[model samples]
Target: MSTFGVIARREIRLALRNRGVVITALIFAVWFPVISALGIAAGAGGDAAAVAGAIATIILPVGVFMGYLFCADAFLREKRDGTIETLLCAPVSLRRLWEGKVAGVAVPAYLTTLLSAAVTIAAVSTLSGTPVAAEPLLFLHLAAVVPVWIAAAAGLIGAAQLALGMRENQILGFVFIFGLIFLIAGLQGVVSGISPVTEAVLAAVGLALLALARFIAGKVTKERIVRTIP
Candidate 1:
């Protein structure tokens, strides 16, 4: 396997072994979708548009939150324990390392978000006594835009964790989490009627942010990270 794949697989293995984090992530992933679906079903009477909108609105935040959960300690833990130094001496470039870590966190996060979506659809159908499904655009949103956003989030958060002190990371982590929560909450009404144009625009924005995060991650140096270690 390539270095990137090896690193990514390692991180995935570590993430899965953290039973506390995994269980917490699973609860959030399942709870939000179920609650949102129940509310939408009660109000919209199993309307496909409403169900789709609820799926679109809830899944993005759930996926991003999962990324945050998995990546919260990915870089920081390594740096704190002095493992990052050894890894840094390896032949792999910093950008590839960042990509690998981001991919590692993003894969499971995206899958959990898919589970959230499925629960949403199932809940809506069960409650409404009809087979309701998401629109294709929403599926496109899930398949394409959601993963990109998760990757961007993981990359940015991992960069922050690597570059900042523990205190700064804690403060900034709270800000990032709350900021994202509020932003998604504010967008709930707007995304409910989301169109193809909106999905395209979101995909473009996610890609741009992912690119920007990659550039930022590439700029993070070993010296800077070592200095930030507590």
Candidate 2:
């Protein structure tokens, strides 16, 4: 196996062992989609396409938030447990390590989001007695755009946690959690802007985030990470 795959597999195993992590993921994966579907369907005014679009929109942000939550456990928890130092000393380069961590978190988070999307679509289809609500564009959004954001968010969060001191990591964690909360609160307002023009905009934003993640990941070196260790 490639070094990246091996590292990612290890993190995945760790995530599975942490029952709390899996449970939290399941709750978010199921709850967010179901709730979003219900809320939009209630006011959808019989527009299945609109309900589908709303659920898709909700899933993207939720996926990004899930990535952050798991990245904390995947990356920051290692620092708390004193394992990060040992891992930093491993033969692999720091960039590879960051790739593994980001991929590890992004894969699971993205899958959970996909599960939520499926559930929401199925539930709405059943309720409305129409198989037509599963919009192709919405699914395309889930399959394409959401994963990019998940990877971007995970990469940035993991890099910061690995590079920063304990105190800064705590502050960052609070900032991220609260920042996501604020975003969720304004979700409806945000969704309105995701039209055709914003499809290109979303893609552009995703690319920018990926570029930033790569920059952050590139900055992670053994010397810097070890210096931050308490």
Q: TM-score: which candidate is best?
A: 1
| Model 2 Cα lDDT, one tens digit per residue, 1-230 | 99999999987778767788779989988877677666766766667666665666677778878788777778777777888878877899888988887888888788887887788888776666546344666766776778887887787778788788888987887676556446544553654633555455565677687788788879777788878878
Tens digits of per-residue lDDT for model 1, 1-230: 89889989988988898888889988987888777876777776656776676667777878778888988988888877888889889998889999999998888888888888888878877887655563687788888988988887788788788778888998887677667666556655554465786677667767887898898888989899879877
Model 1 misplaced regions, further than 4 Å: 184-192
Instruction: Say which candidate scores most in lDDT.
Output: 1
Which pairs of residues clash in candidate 2, taking residues 3 or more apart in a chain or in different chains?
Answer: none
For each candidate in turn, the TM-score is 0.93, 0.88
Question: Which ranges in model 2 have alpha carbons more than 4 Å from their true place?
Answer: 130-133, 177-196
lDDT of 1 at 100: 92
